[model samples]
Target: MTVRDDPRIAMLSVHTSPLDQPGTGDAGGMNVYVTELSQALARRGAQVEIFTRATSSAQPTKVEVAERVLVRHVAAGPFEGLDKNDLPGQLCAFTAGVLRAEARRAVGWYDVVHTHYWLSGQVGWLAADRWDVPLVHTMHTLARVKNAALAPGDAPEPLGRIIGEEQVVEEADALVANTDAEASDLVADYHADPARVHVVAPGVDLEVFSPGTLGRPALRAALGLPADDRIVLFAGRVQPLKAPDLLVRAMGVLAERGEAVPTLVVLGGASGRPTAVRELEALAYQVGVADRLVVRPPVGREVLAQYFRAADVVAVPSHNESFGLVAAEAQATGTPVVAAAVGGLRTIVEDGVSGVLVPDHDPRTWARALADLLGDDVRRAALAAGARRASARFGWDAAAEQMLKVYELAAQVRSAR
Candidate 1:
């Protein structure tokens, strides 16, 4: 707000571009976070530019996302999709591209470099050094944390990524976390200095995801969903860590018991690795619930809001989540969420209030919770009301305000150094 706090942020999201679509490829919450936060920061009077690896030749090298928020696609590796594990090998190339971009700008083009994920943090280290600025990093997901809670068939994270993240933890001038628990993880697991870690929660767009935009019947009709069917929606990547299979298993349970099952629609694309959709289909056939399960590709945000509005409840059964933005967006649309009690989801979904939190990842528990909520309109209505009220308290504007303070801290640290 003051001239002294006008941070010229050079955001680094090396592995995934903010211009990329969410719920597909490697672009999930982190991409949404960067895209929204940068725009919000720009609205609050900061000049921002995002730097990301160019994923394909079709995309232009430069794009203007907002009034003063520009996204620069730095050519690093081949202009094609590469596995996330292989991205580490391209760090030097990415760093070179970043420095080349900086060289083209004036000396004060960027006053501070803010990085998302460890891949970006790796690139941010060199950028911060070259620009003589502070580095603030957000580890959206920790390798060790995900490895410890791998889903049924999910592979453990490699040792190399763990080492890379540890180095980033050490090098970052300040670490930003989505929740207090995540902040504690940095201190306990990564040995981050307590004073250097800040807890800054991500936000949802109220203008787009607000409740009461459309009636459920009309919205479902627009999507061609059966009017008689009670829809249960799941929106995110189809990866095992997200536990899309868990939702399928719950549907199977409902069918086996001869109880009327709500139509389960899973909307998302494959993540880094192939999801278990095929295996889930086989399981659905084995359990006689194939007809009740539907899987569709991810939709745009506005269409996604319609899907959220059409649903009786949204399920988020992830094995691990940094903040569960999908859950928040759904809740903002007046849909109750049934999410796993993990990470920031604990705070996002108020157990027995806005939504129920199943402590364990068992399918039976999820099935019962879904069945009860679907059968009881009174309880679901209460939670739906609570969901809208609770979500109104947080938005992108609030997140941008908090991040400005974190930027000031990073700037202060740079001056001290």
Candidate 2:
């Protein structure tokens, strides 16, 4: 199939802006995925414009984040205090803003529409139909998949979301999944058409995340971390879904066993709830690992790479992950990951090779894994070497090349219909 030349893309991210800082307030891997993917697409000659809901009045209506990538912030509901749950009520307004923006442009300005998350998919459904363009949707997280793996005391995803996702699956010209496992889930759980599903693994910025020349002790000192103490870094939102509590509890288990306890570094801000960070701190206190716990807000990508490099092991205990970006980034920095053997983590971490994958979320199991890895210097060094090799498979350039093909496929399907 002949690929179209530089297809213009209208990228929709209604719930969160690609400009937003990841690891805080509903911003996570999805934001990074959109930002990096757009930049990569642009580098390949694609002109991309991302539309997102305006969270602050101070933001400009449009800003060029990269050479060929633009972010347009559309006003929907009140900028402040509106969460993901509240954004669904504002979809109509958000969609209207998007349509109005396109109406100002020449006819056929956008060749295709690519949307991130379900909320944006809802907007893309109508915009693509109205504009006669193909729609490609990436359901960063699925409602049914997440609900099925909810953490203890975590609320299930709303019924409204399930219905919304179903509609998007039915309407989208193509559905992008982060892993083959996720593609299977889309077909089995969402009952999506197998022909429409495309598995495109996301990539890490190896230039930014690669192992730096600085050694661990020097990197730790530069990052103001304890040079001599072992560090187990958990980089994600402090939420039930992320399972930060399990790490704290695991620290307690390590202490109980009279084993050497590594300092637990929690790097992220409150998400889902305003008091999530405080709650995590309280949990650390309850587990008697408060002194060993360090809470830091999220940093930019370069600094985050340093944290990954300084750590002995990065722990990702999320209840579910459509894709484990944190684990991949850590591994890219030559840091071994200790992740739960679930969803995308299973694909990212190679047990006894790149990193160890705990079979379950048991605190004792995590504690043992952490202790064993931290204690075995020779094994850890071997895994670090393997990690760098393992992470080499994913690159934004390759992901963009495949995505361009998917865009072409979506266009073909739309034209056929």
Candidate 3:
């Protein structure tokens, strides 16, 4: 797998757009990862084209996001948003469009095809077979892993997804995992070939998310947060797996104890179940901490940086995460995080170092951790100062270099086959 040449890559993200704002709709860390990594690859002299299902009628067929990185929007399904569960039926059409796009180019246009998510893997399989290229797949969150971590009152992942993901795991020429834990999940749960599985940790953009860019007190006042109250923020999609309600319930614990509860500021768009935010609102009312809760939609990266800087501590209470990008982003802004100690979060947030990690999903345990981090200014400040240093371990340039190695490995394997 050592012989190397200039590689042309076909990046497939079938269901979501890399241009979309993360933490909203169906876009999250996967979008940021693909967009940032592809840009990095392009900068490193790789010919990259990102293919996504066109969700709107107004989008141009091709957009040049960077100097050589192109986004080719291929129309496959209806021009309106459809549930992810119903996306499999459209993969055939997406695959046709991808092949047609490749047909317009020379025979050796794409040396490797990398797909994000299970839906794109289905299309990548067909395209890569037709193009005679290696297929590398990334499953951001495995269906089986997510189903096992379903929050209380949350619906389980569909059976169709579980079956599709299983097939993707079996068929991919190489699987790119965000962490060793995720790689283990593929090996143990789906029996993925250990030799073909590569654990390449994700990277954060230090340029966009850096420390000491904003004044915390002024930004908090601008965002309408109380100056004195502790602000425990959650900035991501509002879904059952994200467990925004758990943060609200933890606030309830502090409220019942007659302590000044940390204001749980949730900032993101409604996703997955339509009743996600409403369900959280209802639970907040039931817990009698509704007054301390604040929910807002997504914002630009600059404003998001402000929110991160203003926060006393960011809480990532997801049931599971392949990698917690928001935790990394927040840490890059010099804010400590209190995250659920599960999946890649275990690697992102070091206990008693950059941030505090809560072990159990129990509301009381989260309450205790949040209270301790919020109450102790000296310890919190120490974490805040060290947070940027922790985030320095991962940078997008390094990620792209590692991915180039994966591409070469996959290509060498394909050549052997």
Q: Which has the greatest lDDT?
A: 2
Ranking by lDDT: 2, 3, 1
Worst 10-residue lDDT window, candidate 3: 1-10
Error of 2 at 224 (Å): 0.9
Write model 1 residue lDDT over 234-314, tens digit each, in one string.
Answer: 998888899888888888788879888888898988875674567767777887888988888888889999999999999
248-268: candidate 3 lDDT, tens digit per residue:
888889889987788888988
User: Which sequence of candidate numbers ranks them by TM-score, best first?
Assistant: 2, 1, 3
TM-score of 1: 0.97
Between candidates 2 and 3, the one scoring higher on TM-score is 2
Off by over 4 Å in 1: 1-3, 274-276
Worst 10-residue lDDT window, candidate 1 = 1-10
Task: Tell me the alpha-carbon RMSD of every candidate.
Answer: 1.6, 1.1, 1.5
Model 3 spans with C-alpha error above 4 angstroms: 1-5
Model 3 TM-score? Answer: 0.96
**Residues 276-319, model 2: lDDT tens digits:** 99998988888788899999999999999999999999999999
Candidate number with the higher lDDT (2 or 3):
2
Query: Which candidate number has the best TM-score?
Result: 2
Worst 10 residues of 2 by lDDT: 1-10
